[model samples]
Target: MIIRLNDMVFYGYHGVNDEERKLGQRFIVNLEMQTHPETDSVIKRLEDTVDYTKVYAEIREIMESRQFLLLENCANIVADKLLTDFPLIWKLKLCIQKPSVPIQGILKSVEVEVQRTRE
Candidate 1:
């Protein structure tokens, strides 16, 4: 089974620039998780599957807890926590977006994607 949480927006002070750290910006998180639910059985109870609300809470906690210098680092932290906290999650793909990048060019947003699988 798969669980996807898309377009989760949060304001976090995560960037290499000093200004960005002081004045936070919006961060969009997209997480896709592959889980090992009972394939042959019905998911009658919430515990039978991954609770996305709890997953969202964890992600929010990670994003809101501290400042990060790079989106890659943030993604890594999130992936590690998720994989560790939820053993059912066999794999995950996390994407973070920075819309207001302090770059000298026209762009939609700066995005970083990371994929992790449990060994």
Candidate 2:
């Protein structure tokens, strides 16, 4: 089974610049998760599948927990936490977007993506 969560926005203090860490900025996260449920029968109960609510809460907690210098670090933490917390989730793709990047050129956003699977 697959579960997807898209456009999860959060304001966080993450960047290399001091101003960015102090001011913070909006980050959009997209997640795609693949899970394996016991048996191929119809999944009738919440226990049979991964609870996305818990996943969201866990992600929010991680995002808001502290400041990081790179989005890659944040992505790694999210992937690690989710995979560790939920045993059913076998793989995941995570994308994090920094909408307001303090750079020289005008661009839509800067993004970092990572994929992880259970070992």
Candidate 3:
């Protein structure tokens, strides 16, 4: 089954510039994962599925815990953590968006996406 979490926002200190790291900014996270349950039948228990509340908490913790120099690193970190935390997940796709990036031109946001699979 596929589970998706979209537009989870958090304030984080992540950037290449010193000012950006110090001032921090808003970030948006989107996650999609494919999990295999032990049984193909309908999920009757929480243990039969990935608990997304735990997933959100873990993502939030990762975002708030440290400073990343790039969104690519941030996305990768999240993907790695999720894969480790939930072994049932066979594949994951994640995106991190920075809405208040420092740029001379007007733009909506800057985003980075990473996809991973368990081997």
The residue pairs found clashing in candidate 1 are none
lDDT of 2: 0.90
How many Å off is the CA of 40 in candidate 1?
6.3
lDDT for position 2 in model 2: 78
lDDT of 2 by residue, 9-74 (tens): 988999999999998888999999987644326667988778999999998888877899999999
Write down the lDDT that model 3 would get: 0.90
**Superposition error at 41 for model 1 (Å):** 3.6
**lDDT per model vs. reference:** 0.90, 0.90, 0.90
What TM-score, over all chains together, does every model reach? 0.94, 0.94, 0.93
Clashing residue pairs in candidate 2, if any?
none
Q: Looking at model 3, which ten-residue stretch has the lowest summed lDDT?
A: 35-44
In angstroms, how far off is 37's CA in candidate 1? Answer: 6.5
lDDT tens readout by residue for model 1, 50-98? 7899999999988877899999999999999999998778889999999
For candidate 1, the TM-score is 0.94
